[model samples]
Target: MTGAVATAPAARTGRAPAPRPVSPTARQMRRAGWWFLAVPLALFVVFMLLPMGMAAVISLTDYAIIGDTAWVGWQNYARIWDDAFFWTALRNTARYTLMYVPLGLVVALGTALLLNRSYRAVRLFRTLFYIPVVSSTVATATIWYWLLNPQKGLLNVALGWFGIDGPRWLYDSQWAMTAIVLMSVWAGFGTNMIIFLGGLQGVPGDLYEAARLDGANVWQQFRYVTLPSLTRTTFLVSTLLIIGAFQVFDQAYVLTKGGPGNSTVTMVYYIYNKGFGSLEMGYASALSFVLFLIILVFSLINARLNRPGDGGRVRRRRVPAAVPSAVAAR
Candidate 1:
């Protein structure tokens, strides 16, 4: 037994070494995680991050499609600052946003309110409104192009019935942006409508009942209850709409090519022409960065403005009417 004990100590002391310091399962899990992220990370690096970096580099150079390039050191941006066409496009985009965002909000909110009630065709109506949102922008543009055609178009034809000749829509510089705004609203409002519907449904039923009991009218209740409650959704929708409006491209591209005296020219279309048509890619990249900065700033502003109870970028809604009918009766 004493010999066995001494032998056991010797055996333990000489044990073949500690197990290899490794966790196969943990290693395998880490490998699997990388594998899982490989696709999106590769995609992001290639498509988004790489493009942005390349664009930034390009912006710094006086790069061109043909001939050896030189780094002009903000020359393109300096030129962009003085370019009248750039100003026109920027102005046009601002006007487009001013018109599009508010108009879109009104139509979407109104549609949502109309559809909020229980009705037989409510589901169908929801789907109907949603169809346009999913519809192809190119197809919508073509349809609109036809409808707004000066002579035989549906819009002008209808105007003739009322003894008023509608002005040439797409052909006229004055009416071109307006026409685009109308169609854009038609295409874009449905999504916001759905968002508003979800918000309205989420509003507390007891609040409505309380307002009713206090004798608040429909509009009053909407002002006091609905508008205030729907703030976050409205803010998001408005910001999105504003951003999209600033980046207006397809309609301007397809409809008028920014023509009829450059009326509907937008920043994106201008950049596109510079990059592809003129092959002034360096200048275009600069324009793109400027645009990106502008968008980021405004988005940040809108976000800041929409927060609760702070003197911020947006004006908060206030309504003063909430005493129940029962309370009044008493």
Candidate 2:
């Protein structure tokens, strides 16, 4: 009888179990989620992906606004190789990125460190620092235009009090880019400061206590504990700074208009001139692709360099013998 029962069950096992039915509410919620995502997805395809596809196609042809559109294959891209202005703009942008990213990082991180405490005054200071970020870029540039005036400007006037002559800021080719860098950093660092402040607040308090117990000084704690903990935040800030520096336009446009021998002409400004000013849409599109590639390369490098599990580039030093092993492990 047992053998017959087992045989009967084995015969029934060949048939699969019926699937469970999903509830009406579960199905409705899933449908609603897709419905919510549809608008953004449609917008993304219409605006971003469509324009990018159009730009890629446009880059392959000589599509001057009023002229006959003719396919030029890769000639437009080849022209970029010999374009002296393109190279100059790229070099100026690189210089700006080098100056702007490091300085901005330092200023933002410094301000964030200073304001990471809990106090009524700290809240006021954070708001004050963030004001420049929300201010209109054109308005900020206008203000800097007067402040950087070579002869009668506030910056030079203050220098005059010290008996040191301030260099011609926007007017001098040598200093035009520098002045723009200064303005860009001052106007933009507040956003990065806020980002860093968030990161600082997220760091585990236990790590600081561990470091303190291990006899770590403030600088040592910052260098080892804080620096390691904030690597991802630093990476994000630096990447944003690099992208922004390459595309800088309003400051250069409002302050210098890419003047003083094209010293402050960024890649985006040059592309704007080609596309709209000169109406070489094909060439401009090609330049834009090149700029995109450059940004992508730099961003990839930054990501690899700051990837988790690598403790960043902070120099390791011997901790005092009295320091605990826990601090050293960090």
Candidate 3:
């Protein structure tokens, strides 16, 4: 009986024996994949995660560039609440964002609408518009300075034709922010216009055809079909414009120099002054964290407003958010 049991396969088919069962190779391969990810994981930890942790630590201390860093445990944050300069900078940035973003959206959308039609030189026109975005900010600022100069400016000369008094665009505190707003809109509208143009193209033509068949006019079709479809693109463009307006530095740095009595001073310029100019790295670091928090809050508000169910949502982006809930959508 024992011999029969051991030789059952041999007895049945005259085969020597069956080979031992092997483990699933796919599971082993999956296990191998864990090790394969180790390098990239390590790099993310070292480069991204490590730096953020260090910044958070530095934000808690009172370290200057040349002196010892002392931990006062939220004192920096407390100080920020009472800082008038910080408040002014924040207010200025908010005003700048409001002025530029709405005007930019309107102008970009209008331009995009015009360019959506057939044009022979559409490519050239598009390039001409986008040239400023890729050009150096310093160069653009310098050109703007000459164009908006108080006495010898081309704009004021044009104003002379209308017999209307023009403001000293770059010199007067009242007009300084206004001039910056105009320059920002001109420089930035092109990018958003291009984006909107691309979005308009993505809108299917069949909808327009169907609307036309239903006796829909251009305005009606756009109001019903076009706007609904372009919601996502509009949201994306608005968020970008808002963020850019908030973070404005280069133009203010080169043109107004945060002046006409700090009327054009943005939060970033304020932070830069605190960090490098005054050598208060710790205070600057705290300010940097506060700026980060502000950005984070705005970003959250943007995303929340733009989400699918939120009525006025924009397109979801490929870039990750800077704060929590960046993972929630996933």
Candidate 4:
């Protein structure tokens, strides 16, 4: 009778049992998660999305602070094409990007390589390298300003020890942009170095061991293993460099004021002059969108060039026949 009773439900009904009710603890935790997420989501909407919407609307209107606002409807964008100063600023910004991105990548990757070891003082050196990144941009520029003074600055004084005359960095148009590039690299490379370090650490120990077993030298192992592994990190760093290069304003304003004949005038600096200096908010907004588009295009190009599969395929083809089956498997 007991067995029949136990089997009666399975024989009489085929439907599955209902799900268990939510536990009070789990419900409370779920609510807490939403509450936690709401804070950053609210902040993002308020600070980022709202401002972007406002700028888009403002870009279509002539809204100088002291005058009646009028709808202009793409006139400002049209004007940008005819503005010679805009092109010059763009050219200067491009020149800075060209110099800064490669040098920044090299300095960052080199520093990461040097520090990617177990040592007592490694953390201290990393902290020292990162100090410039956390330091205020204006303060850093001010320091570099003093450092680049051709007459008595530390840089030129060191040059004097080597019997080489240093050029007037900030004061000379020819070297002003280069000086800014150097300062930018020094101030920013620490962040990229940390990123590279993270990427380096993620690389498999087995890959290096296999490379050594295959008679690969230091450079060959780096080329075949480390570089391939770090492709995404490189793309991330380079894209950031390009965007920051375009939006550069603080260092130029603090160090050179876009001068020694506007040689250091960047897109953001020019936009700042238009918006605040000349009270052309609409035009500046238009320029901002244009700069955003440029950044977008360049980032897409960088992503396409650094696609993981593309590099992986090439590397696979390049792997020497002498490499062992174990290395090939990795």
- Local distance difference test scores for all models: 0.85, 0.90, 0.81, 0.90
lDDT of 4: 0.90
TM-score of 2: 0.91
Estimate, for each residue in 1-330, the C-alpha lDDT of model 4 and write its tens digit. 999898789778986667899999999999999999999999999999999999999999898888799999999899999999999999999999899889999999999999999997999999999999999998899899899988999999999999999999999999999999999999999999999999999888988898788787788778777888888789888888888888888889999999989999999999999999999999999999999999999888888888855543224556777655445555
lDDT of 4 at 200: 96
How many collisions between residues are there in candidate 4? 0
TM-scores for every candidate against the unseen true structure: 0.82, 0.91, 0.79, 0.91
Ordered by lDDT, highest first, the candidates read 2, 4, 1, 3
**Residue 314 CA error for candidate 4 (Å)?**
6.1
Model 4 worst lDDT window (10 residues): 308-317
The model with the greater lDDT, 1 or 2, is: 2
Q: For residues 1-330, could you state the per-residue lDDT of candidate 2 as single tens digits?
A: 998886786577786556899999999999999999999999999999999999999999999999699999999999999999999999999998999989999999999999999999999999999999999999999999999998789999999999999999998999999999899999998899999999998888998898888778898788777888899899999889888988888888899999998898999999999999999999999999999999999989888887845644343365455555566776
lDDT of 1 by residue, 1-330 (tens): 998886796687886645776699989999999999999999999999999999999998978889889988888889888998899889999889889988999999999999998988998999999998899999999999999999999999999999999999998888999999999999888999999899889887877787786678888677666776787788878888978988889989988889889999899999999999999999999999999988888888888877634321223223222445432222
Output the better candidate (2/3) by TM-score: 2
Q: What tens digits encode model 3's per-residue C-alpha lDDT throughout 14-119? A: 8766677667896688789998899899999999889878767877887776867788778888999999999999999998888988899999999898878777
Which regions of candidate 3 fall more than 4 Å away from where they truly are?
1-48, 308-330
Where in model 2 is the C-alpha error above 4 Å? 1-19, 309-324
Lowest summed lDDT window (length 10), candidate 2: 308-317
Please give the distance, in angstroms, between residue 194's alpha carbon in candidate 4 and its true position after superposition: 0.9
Alpha-carbon runs more than 4 Å astray in model 1 = 1-41, 308-330
Q: Backbone clashes per model, in order?
A: 7, 0, 2, 0
